[model samples]
Target: MPRETLFTKIVAREIPADIVYEDDLCLAFRDIAPQAPTHVLVVPKEPVESIDSLTADHQELAGHMMLVCKKVAAAEGLSAGYRVVINNGKDGGQSVDHLHFHVLGGKSLKWPPG
Candidate 1:
């Protein structure tokens, strides 16, 4: 089995986080360092390394994460628009080992994101 990750620690309540949303399946929390006016992470409770690790059975989990992202965006007053980013691997800029969705809004995010 894989070792625990930062996100797993948070989910286990071993570390504190600025959690914004929580349900039976996942949780949404504010980013430690804000990238935009509003930046939060929508994460699944079940730690699956990254999107590359998901199987057919995990499809519902992925969809659920997206729905939670929308819910979090609205809750954060990002009615104008928002961006959901999933950094898959090293080349995709995934700093964390766990799969997570970045919900960013409250500003004009440029195209061709870094």
Candidate 2:
């Protein structure tokens, strides 16, 4: 079945994206709408809808995404610090339907990110 999300389209190569990293299980791409100097989206190839839907089977993928986030941050020279975010629902400011982890860094990030 077709994945019901923009991220799915990106993963399926149906949409153009500046990909930074890719593996058998996931892909990391630059966020078209960047919030920081080094903003990237790390996502799994699976059709997970959101973080809330993650299960035991997704544990390894989730960990892989975190490792990828760290690797990307280091590559982007964000050694000081960084933020990893996953917007859960509409109220959480998630516009995309697929599960994704946002890696934000390369500058002093403010507290209480909006």
Best model number under TM-score: 1
Candidate 1, 1-114: lDDT as tens digits: 556998999999899999999998898888998899999998889989999999999999999999999999989999999999999999999999999999999999999887
lDDT to native, each model = 0.92, 0.90
Query: Which portions of model 1 miss their true places by more than 4 Å?
Result: none
- In the range 19-97, model 2's lDDT, one tens digit per residue, is 9999998999999989999899999999888898899989999998899999888888888999999999899988887
TM-score of each: 0.97, 0.93
- Residue-level error in angstroms, candidate 2, position 79: 1.0
lDDT score, candidate 1: 0.92
Error of 1 at 35 (Å): 0.9
Q: Clash number for model 2?
A: 0
Clash totals for all candidate models: 0, 0
Residue 88's lDDT in candidate 1: 92
